[model samples]
Target: MLDLTKLAQQMQGISQQLTLEATATRQRLDRAQLLMAQANERQADLVQMQELWRDRLNFTAAMPLESLDTRIEIAAPPAAHTVIATDGSQIAPSHHEIAYCYLINVGRIILHYGQSKLPLLDSLPEVFYRPEDLYVSRQWGIRTEEWMGYQRTALEAQILAELAQALTDEMEAPTLALTDGSLIYWFLEQLPAEARDRILAPILAAWDQLRAISVPLVGYISASRSGEALNFLRLQSCPYLAPDCMTHCSEVVDRAPCQVLDPLKDAALWAIRLEPGQRSPLWKSSARIQEFYGDHAIHFCYVNVGSEIARVEVPAWVAADEDMLQSALSLVLGQVQKGYGYPVALAEAHNQAVVRGGDRARFFALLEQQMIKAGLRNVGTSYKETRKRGSIA
Candidate 1:
């Protein structure tokens, strides 16, 4: 038989080693469990923070009604004189095609004029004229290249010159020229020195002449629906106010007292009270806040133009709720259609194809039919066909 005492001692040492190993492994497992629990806690905290942020934003976006006190009154239209509403539209590629469409109405007589640069692509150099009085097409040497900047400048100069000439040629003596937009044209800065001088010199001269003759030179922007101020108000869930009111509010918000307000705080306050189709006018006193606050305090006053009376000054960031995006877009589109007379009827034409069913001949036939319906006489259609060669026998 072996030595019992020696075997017992060896077994005890082995058991001790196994017990130490098991204790170490259990400690490691406990550490891992603690780390996992900490990670889960951090995740929950993050989620809670996000939820709090959203709630805060939503609350600040709620509309505030503190200063809306003015009563609503519809102003009568000003005494109608010879009103001429002129609008200019510019297209890209070759800026040569600058379209200046104007509506001149004196009493019952209405005159519409659209002057555009005739595109001389390839070898054709021509000027197409279509007016209420005369329809004339003449070949004029005008070349346009692919350079957008140079083309834009050249086209603006040409159009401005044409506009000045048209003003003198069409109107007898000095007459009032009422432009449909802002007095200063934004594109004026983009033109070259010579072109700029050429374009503006005559315009200023015309203005001087009009001033001398007591002819009023008025410009009306007609409350642009796409204005940034209006859009911001709409996004903030406050669209009922006039564009000018929103503009004033934006100005105030940028200043001292209002700027200090936490974005989320303001948004929460404004979002709750601001309703759809709500409108308010910011007062002159509020507009002069900079004078009162001395570059420190923020002040805004608004008179409710909407049926409901709620006025709130809020930060822009609070207004950027994701839920407001679609509503803002719809409001903008509606405003654009109502204010700008954008063609809602012809919206389907936006997707209409030039050719359909992969049949070129049929497309031409359909085009001719459309032309005929549009009162074009003696409409003709022609096309070139490609033929495939037969394989050699």
Candidate 2:
């Protein structure tokens, strides 16, 4: 039972906070105006800043390092194009359950844009119970959800890449492989090196497989709030004189160069520039994951998807190849138009992968039945769970 009265009281505070933030954001944008105009003038100093703080700063590069103003016109999808997408859902391990287990379900959709054929849809659900699957490290403490979630996400990409590779190998026409987030495995950076490698090795292998197949794989982040580009703009605000990056920005907050645009996101910055189906200039990622990727470093562009500006991520190989880039853009925009401002294949994959409340109840019931048949005592749930369900008989 939700406490609507309490929730309503909380809403007032949220509304007030939003209003204050909005005002601050506008002021920040105003301060950023001069720097935005003088971006070209300040571009030369960014490298020196990077060189100086190469070890100190955690921010990504401030702006486009090369090809600052190249906007390619929107191209139409090929007459015979195939759009493939994959998404995932997961059930975290519950201590109250009879078995200490977790599940990951990946759903994929392959839709032919021009052909009059039915779309191929399938879901692969796996239950993990092995000791290795259930292992939790001292670093994670009691939180295994993050570990399992990362694995599920990585698996989703691997699965999508594998499917894309197999289909691309047989297809004659242009095929676009789409996934629902950044292609770079950014989350693994916080983990210990060995742990990160253990998880990322297979994902990297799958990326290699996709590259070998020569398919255009794109990651679509809808309503992206990524401020990677804006971080570059922040560099423009650094007042430290060129060749002397000695003084850090933190010490001179008021004297810092471009604070006005601090509140704006990359999406907000590009919203005014890009038209529907058009993509903004490509920019390289400065994430730590970039080092691991090397030649396959992640690069991104902003696309106006009619509804909102979406950030699309691709490996360097895809970005460097004009044909592949154009194909990815056209296919993604076409999918968005067909999906009424969202990609239909991704939506379908998500729908297929979702684990509903009813499904969870049934899963627990089945597990209990199996336990009983095995001559085990009934595994009762915790008092908290029982209270939440209000005496389920």
lDDT for each candidate structure = 0.30, 0.78
Model 2 root mean square deviation, Cα atoms: 2.9
Candidate 2: what lDDT? 0.78
Model 2, which residues run further than 4 Å from truth? 1-23, 30-33, 41-53, 62-66, 136-142, 243-246, 250-258, 391-393
> Tens digits of per-residue lDDT for model 2 on 86-134?
8999888878666788889899898986776568898888888787778
In terms of lDDT, which candidate is strongest?
Answer: 2
Quote model 1's TM-score.
0.26
User: CA shift at 133, candidate 2, in angstroms?
Assistant: 1.0
Could you tell me the TM-score of candidate 2? Answer: 0.89
Query: TM-score of each candidate?
Result: 0.26, 0.89
